[model samples]
Target chain A: MIILIIIGMSLVTMIPRVIPAFVIEKMQFRPWVNRWLSAIPYAALGALIFPGILSVNPDKSQIGLLGGIVAVILAYIGLNVVLVVIGAIITVYFLSL
Target chain B: MTDKAEIYSSTAVHMIKRGFITGIPIMLGYLPVAITYGVLAKQAGMTLMELTLMSVMVFAGASQFMGVNMIAVGTGTLEIIIATFVLNFRHFIMSLSFMNQLRELKLKWKIPLSLGLTDESFAVSSINKDEAKMEKGAFFYGTIISIAYLSWIIGSFLGGVLGDVIPDRLSQSMGIALYAMFIGLLIPSIKKEKKIAVIALFAMLIHALCIQLGMSTGWAIVAGTIIGGMSGIYLLKEDVA
Candidate 1:
């Protein structure tokens, strides 16, 4: 049962990731379609961060929020991604303590 | 070998080196999250082999996390698979844009290259200034994805082995790491195009509203992404091509 689940999961996941490469290459999208596709990364980044970030520490959701804020500030100030992540981890650690 | 062929090969070598080096930060970013996934999946009763297989086969952090959580609660396999599909459907868009960006490459590279199109890999490849111009750009992009992919697998394996040794508070704190990385990746883009900030903000609002109405996180993100991208079609005037 577990193995079946894993295989099923892999199929669904890989299909979305792989099919576009084979299909999209042969097709030509209009300007608006390309615009929508181009915007997806930013949209994905936004959706990935919010709501999920707050719930990372469900018991004290503020810890996640504070960490997110620290990350934003550090990233805004042009810190390298590694440092920004480290800074957020430190903030969350201290807050959780 | 002809002089031009030698020059092309050397440039390809250079780009491959650059790709691996550029992947370092993403590797760093993936380690903690991958470890977290390992630990959580283990606690959820997954055997070491199962967790590792999931990491290797699925190769998606967020969906793997959700899959394990569902498994822990004894959710049906179909439900879990459906959720995984919805959560990962965003990759279709990413893959489309990514292939278009590297259209200079042959079709043969796109299949394997698309397999590695995670959020972090896609973002880095898309933002790279020299991506379109490099010789063997597929190999360069593949190297970047390969480094990050190796880190994920290694980190998950280590986490499975070292599960009980890691402190609870520290692992919990690591939960914030992936989100931090996302912000880091997004900020530079937002800085360049202030309109991107609006797109991000709008997506967040839509996601929040979806959650308020009792949508699953997976579906909500899809909703937010589609709606947000549509908003961009109007907000962004520049030609994407």
Candidate 2:
């Protein structure tokens, strides 16, 4: 049963992703359809960062907020992405402690 | 056509190397979190085989975490599947977006490639999409996905073994890196496009309000994406006009 659930989860998780790859390109999409597609990443990332990050930590939950701020500041300045992530993690760790 | 084929065949190895190089940072980034997953999974009473199976089959971070949590709590199988599907609905959008760039590749490559489309690889692939020929692009994407896949599995397996030794505080702190990476990815786009800024703000506000109104995480993310993506398209249309 557990095995079946894992398989089912994998199938459900993957189908939405895999189906689109095969289908979307076959249909000649409009420019705005294309634009909205490009826009999805930024929109998804933006959405994930906000309310998602806000509720992350269990202890010292405020650290998530501060960490996000640190990330925004560091990323805004055009630091390397790896550096930005490290910077935020360090900031969150210190402030939380 | 022959020239294009020749060029593609010749460039494949170089693109793979580039993909490998691009994947290194993301691989490094995934290590701590993947390990954290293993450690947590172990703590949740999952056997090593089960733990490995989860990482291998799922390969998604957030969903795996939720899957383990649900399993521990004895949530219904259908519920676990649905929740995970919802959390990962973003990938459908990602796949569609990437499809435009990857149209030149054969169906075989696209199928496997989509299976490996984690958030990290998608960001890396899209950011670097236009740098080279289309085949090269596929190889680059393949490399990134392959390396990330290898590292993530290894990290999780090791964490399952060594999770007992890692201190709680350090493990907890490492969790911040993924969020930081998301911000890092967003910053560049926001710098290039003012419309992205508007879309981001819209998404964030909608998501925050959804949460405040007590919606589920899945629903909140869906709300945010639609509002954000629609507003972005509208803004881009206005800019073009």
Name the 10 consecutive residues with the lowest summed lDDT in model 1 chain B. B126-135
Per residue, candidate 2 scores C-alpha lDDT tens digits across A23-66 of 95578777777677666677777777887676558655688888
lDDT of each: 0.85, 0.79
lDDT, residue A28, model 2: 79
The residue-by-residue lDDT of candidate 1 on B1-241, one tens digit each, is: 6998999888889888988877877887788778878888899998999999988898999889999999999999999999899888878777877877776777788888889888888877776736666667777898898988899998888878888555888878888877888898899888988999999999999999999999877788888888987888987776543
Specify the highest-lDDT model's number: 1
Docking class of 2: medium
TM-score of every model?
0.92, 0.90
Alpha-carbon runs more than 4 Å astray in model 2: B1-10, B132-135, B237-241
How many angstroms is the interface RMSD of candidate 1?
A: 1.7
Q: What is the lDDT of candidate 2?
A: 0.79
